[model samples]
Target: MDVLSDVMTVLRTGRPFAARFAKSGPWSDHRIGRPNGFGVQLMVRGTAVAVTEGGETYKLGPGDALLVPHGAAHLVADSPDTPPGPRCEPGHAFPGAVLRSDDPEATHVILCLAYELAPNRNHPLIATLPDFVHIPADPGERPGLAGAIAMLDGELASEQRGGDTLVPALLDAVLMYLLRALLGPRTVECRFAGWATALADKAVGPALEAIHAAPARQWTVASLGEVAGLSRSAFAKRFTELVGQPPLAYLTSWRLTMAARLLADTEAPLASIARQVGYGSEFAFAAAFKRDFGTPPGQFRKQAPACDPGAEPFRREAVAV
Candidate 1:
């Protein structure tokens, strides 16, 4: 897997819900924000407005999309001056909802999605992104984005074969498309210190690939610098500037993240998991794990239920379409 793929794999993803609806009258939705959630809004057929609590406003038109990576309190309405409307119900009320307005002369179709984003570690991928990311109406347009959203709609409307398995995968695909749109190739314009700049950078991208590819390897900054074809001092400076962490620091975090994922999903003993993630002894790994995750390896493993990727997705614990 590549760097983003590795991060996505390491992080734990929970149930995701989506709703598409059409409205024609004066309508607005107020959001208090989900500090632990990620949200997406797409203007499917007409116009809408998004405003942050800090008074920043963005006008979204057809084909435009916005991502609230760390759900911030905001308002989405037909116009900026529109008054706040009633708060929405929980995720259970979102799926397959076709809320319409009283009037039928005009129409504004929108797609709203919510995802439970829980990270096992301090992932920079989510940490360093801005408060909101808005992909222009036609900036690097992707035909597959709408298709992915439509697939989610189809699944929600009527569960298809492997719906449990397919829904989460579709959510991941839609999110990736949004992210890729945000981080266009080497010419990306976002002022991101994380994956956007790091992955596109020539010197740091290769080093990141090496660290993610072989976390078990005993890596030093010098070795990583050699891989980047730069001197140790030069590479360290550039890598820190772009990636928000030194090469060795990043390597350690990746190693621990892999260990946490292994504990969550596998039945391997501590010794085996430790060795696979570059720790020498079970005792040493336990100390490091406690320092980082605030819990011992045994307790963490016991508390975390296995979430196998290839297995069935989340059970509808009071969830309904």
Candidate 2:
């Protein structure tokens, strides 16, 4: 699998939640906050404005999309001056709620999707992103994104058979498109060295895939350089420049991340977990784990909450329109 897909597999938890808002006339503002995850907003029609908690305002037009990666509390409104309505309780929505303006000419429609990530595990790629990633509407933009939005709109508008199974899958596709759009070559001028740059780099991308594909392998600078088709020194410099860390340092972080996942999700013994994460012995792995996580592996596991692998996906929730 590619680097983005692998990262999603490791970091994402539960299915995504989606809601649609259809309104005519002036609409009361809605505040959305996702403490445990992130929120994505798409303008399907008309116009709207999003005000971050920090007082930054972003105007969104039809076809525009925004990613609130930090889940900051924000206000969505038809205009900047619109007053916010009562706070919508979590997982509850008023039946037949629709916002109407005094003027008959105003109309707006929007779609919001929420994705839950592993709360305890903070992926480096996610950390590098800004508070928001905005993709403006463009007539010549990638058609796949528009098509996905259209399909999602259709699914929500009609009572089609198998929609329960299909909507979640479509939301997942929308997320992939959003990430791909954000990481596209056009955004290569990003200020910081992060996953977007690392994934796009010719040399670092392959090396990253290699490291992820074989976390248990006894890889060194030379081996990784061979994978990247670079000399050892060149590979180390480029990897560190684009990924914000030296190759070996990144490898250790990834290994420990995998070990933590195994500790939480599986019943494997500590020695096996150590071997799987490339440690030579239980003692060495425990030492590293303690240093990195500030807790021993056994205690970490004991304190971990029970994980329900078969938990239901995507509890539907909506905001008052």
The top-ranked prediction according to TM-score is 1
What would the TM-scores of all predictions be?
0.85, 0.84
TM-score between candidate 2 and the true structure:
0.84
Clashes of each: 0, 2
- What digit string (tens of lDDT, one per residue) describes model 1 on residues 264-315? 8889999999999898999999999899889998999888745454554444
As a whole number from 0 to 100, the lDDT of residue 179 in candidate 1 is 77
Summed over model 2, clashes come to 2
Task: State the C-alpha lDDT per candidate.
Answer: 0.74, 0.75
Runs in model 1 with CA error above 4 Å? Answer: 89-106, 153-162, 187-191, 305-321
Q: For model 2, where is the 10-residue window of minimal lDDT?
A: 94-103
Q: In candidate 2, how many Å is residue 221 off?
A: 1.4
